[model samples]
Target chain A: MSTRGQTHLWVVQRVTAMILAVAVLVHLVTIIGAVRGGLSAAEILGRTRGNGAWFAFYAVFALSAGLHGAIGLRNMAAETIGLRGRGADIAWLAIGLVTAGFGIRAAYGLFA
Target chain B: MAEPASLKVSVWRGGEQGDFARYEVPARANQTVLDVVTHIQRELDPSLAYRFACRVGMCGSCAMTVNGRARWTCRTHVRKVVGADGELELRPLANLPVIRDLAADLAPFFDKWQRAQGRFQPKDAPDGAVPEDFVVVPPASKARREADAGIECIGCAVCYASCDVVAWNPDYLGPAALNRAWTLVNDVRDGAHGDRLDAVAGDAGCHSCHSTQSCTERCPKNLDPSSAIAGLKRRLFWDTLLGRR
Candidate 1:
């Protein structure tokens, strides 16, 4: 990869990592609290469905996770299997697209 | 007085496909790993091929893989590295072509250093200014401090030998080279900042480091190549943002 491309990918990976740190904490806390509070699925869905703020939060979470996982997957293949060049680039991009597709769909289903 | 038992030393005796040649050498109190190698070469087998200069730790030529770790053999005392089994193992540095029994060819390592532009380029001395006119950098300055961090490298391939990145990717510049480049990047008197940053920012450069800190762990000089690589990353981004590169 070119210098600029590598630098941008590095920055994106770090940024997504920071985002995931907070997202993961919020997600774990919410789920644990809901279970402890005896909130049923219907009751939980009532608050999440049609909620703009919740949709936006989950959207950001999904996108950040998708981007972060793809970059990490790309690095794993490169370091472990010596994968590089255009093929590896395309593979990571495809992984990112599919991951974001599913994640966003799930997030939107629950809230949008 | 009771005589101490001899150390069972196993030295690698050939190229990549070589077998371990065992020998029983009389141990001494201050016997170093290099001293054992020297004894094996001088007394046991005159045909043993190894490289060393300035038997002290100043010269980096005496480095070898001792007991599964890269180290400067001269500074490594047998007492410190001797296993409970009263044995020692020695081999050529890993991740390099073995030119002989204990000396891995350093050409590839040096080539990577050159690839990373690990050299000082004077901006103020185009015509080679006199020593009195040299750029006198203060010791407390950031540039000087950063440069000092990486300046003690003796070109020992211990860090290179210990790095898994180099083992995984042959094209990677390894830690020592990138660390040297990071020093050059921080040098205020050095004019080739953009070129140095460009040389060390891509797949084969600082970005390739996984920050596993294997280099920092195995470095005999106690230098941190991982931190240097991080510095390079930060500096490279700043340079790009400032339109310096």
Candidate 2:
């Protein structure tokens, strides 16, 4: 990859890390609150379904995670196992796409 | 005469996958870890192998894991590293392939130095006469001072061994290499700032570092390679944005 592209990846990783930190905290707190209140999965689904704000938050979180994790894995593979070149890049791109697809699909399920 | 105080030292033996062999060596007052290893080799076993030069702290040789932490054995006093029981565990540096006992294969470690373009590439010919001959570098400048703080790295691989990024990613250029690149980048006479940034800006370069500061902590010289890597990151970001790299 070009030097600029690498810098962009590093920046994206930092940004995603920040997003994940907040998302994980919020998710954990919500889970704790629901469990303490004896909320059922059905009840949670009823409130979350068609909730635009929740859907948007989760979508952003998932996309960030997908991008961050894919890039990280690509770097790990290249450095640790000596895997590089176009093949590694393509594999990472595919992984990112799949993760983002699943994330978006789940978000849509909640929203639709 | 009272029997000499013998400390049971366990030194790693063999290749990448090996077991620690126990050796009984006489412990002396103010003896360094390197001294202990030397004694074991000289007195007990000629087969035990390790690497050391200068027997001081200059060559960056003599690095080994003492009590679960990477250290320059020549300078690391056993009292400081050993636990209350006076036991010492010596092994090869982490995150690198062990060539033999305490000697690791430094090919990958040094190769990354080349990848980072750590050498100074001067723009002008050595014999060429310049319009303004002297390049004045003021020691008082912040950049020069920042460069000076980490100028003493001995290529010991201590920082590299301590770095978690290197453990996670073997292709990572490592702390010492990136630190060298940072110094070269700040050099006023060096004309390859753009190329150096290009070399170190990538996935296996300074970008791989997670800012864990393990390099800073385990550095025997007390140099902050973490700061150097951070400087490279910032410089690379600016260079990339400005189309300089």
Candidate 3:
């Protein structure tokens, strides 16, 4: 890979990390607020469902988590175990799919 | 006169497949790790092999694992390394091919240096004019200051041996080479900036370094390869985004 590509990835990874920092914090705070408001799952779903705004927020969270996690796993393989090959690439894709699948599905379950 | 005593030293005795052979060398007031190895080779075992050039620290040849850390044995004092048992354990430099006892093949270390473009490529003159005799860069310039931080690395494998990334990733260009590349990249006279950046940008290059600071913590010359690697990463980040490369 070109240095430019690698550098771009570095930027993407860090930027996603920052997004995740904010996203996770917002997610936590939202959950705490919901609990403090004594909102049931039915009530939470009633509030979140058909809401484009909540859907958009969760989508960003899922996207950031996927990008951050996939990049991190790629880095871990390269740096920790020295795994760099077609196998590693395929593995990264698989991990990204699995992680994003769960995150996006839950977001859809609540917001869609 | 004082009581005559000996230092309990454990010297590694063979190639990669070997164990530490114990020796009771005559302990002196100002003994160094190199002195112990030299004494063991000369007096006890004629077959013991280790490399040393300058008895002083100028030559980086005598680097070995004293106790557990990579050190230039020529400059490392015995008093500094001896445990409570007054024992010293000597082994070949870690993460290298040990040709024999205490003598590690540094070819990989040097090979990575070339891979990192650790050399000076002169810049051409502007407007098709002849190249000047010299390029005047200020001593206090940011580039010069950054370059100066790592320019003093003596090609010693101490940093290479200390790097955990190298231990995990054989293809990763180790710290000494990357540090050299960093100095060259910051050099105002150097022209192969893009090529140098590209060389160290891939999976097995600068980005692979986990910033463990092992190289910085153990550098015999006190150079911060961790910082140099960071500079390389930051430069690559901007050059990549700005299309400067």
Tell me, by lDDT, which candidate is best.
Answer: 1
* Reference-based TM-score, model 1: 0.92
Model 2, span B1-245: residue lDDT tens: 22247777888999987998998777787889999998888888888889998988999988888878889999987777765555789999998899899888888888888988888776564343452566789998877887788789999999988987777776778999999999988887777777788788877788878888999998989999999999988876666556665
Choose the strongest candidate by DockQ.
3
What is the alpha-carbon lDDT of model 2 when measured against the actual structure? Answer: 0.83
Question: Comparing candidate 1 with candidate 2, which one achieves the higher TM-score?
Answer: 1
| Total backbone collisions, model 2 | 1
What tens digits encode model 3's per-residue C-alpha lDDT throughout A1-112? 4555666767778778888888899889988888885778798988789998888888888877887789788888776666777677777868886887888888899876
Model 3 local distance difference test score: 0.85
Ranking by TM-score: 3, 1, 2
Candidate 1: tens digits of C-alpha lDDT, residues A1-112? 6767877777778778889999999999988878885879797888799998888888889888888899888878888887888878888978887898888898789885
Say which prediction, candidate 2 or candidate 3, comes out ahead on TM-score.
Answer: 3
TM-score per model (chain B):
0.93, 0.92, 0.94
Question: Cα RMSD (Å) per model?
Answer: 2.5, 4.9, 2.8
State the C-alpha RMSD over the true interface residues for candidate 2, after superposing those residues: 3.1
Clashes of each: 0, 1, 0
Summarize candidate 1's per-residue lDDT along B1-245 as a digit string, tens digits. 22347889888988988999999999888889899999998998999999999888788998999999999999998889888766899999999999989999999999999999998888766564543466778989998899899999999899999999899889889999999998988888888787888888876788778889999998999999999998998887666556666
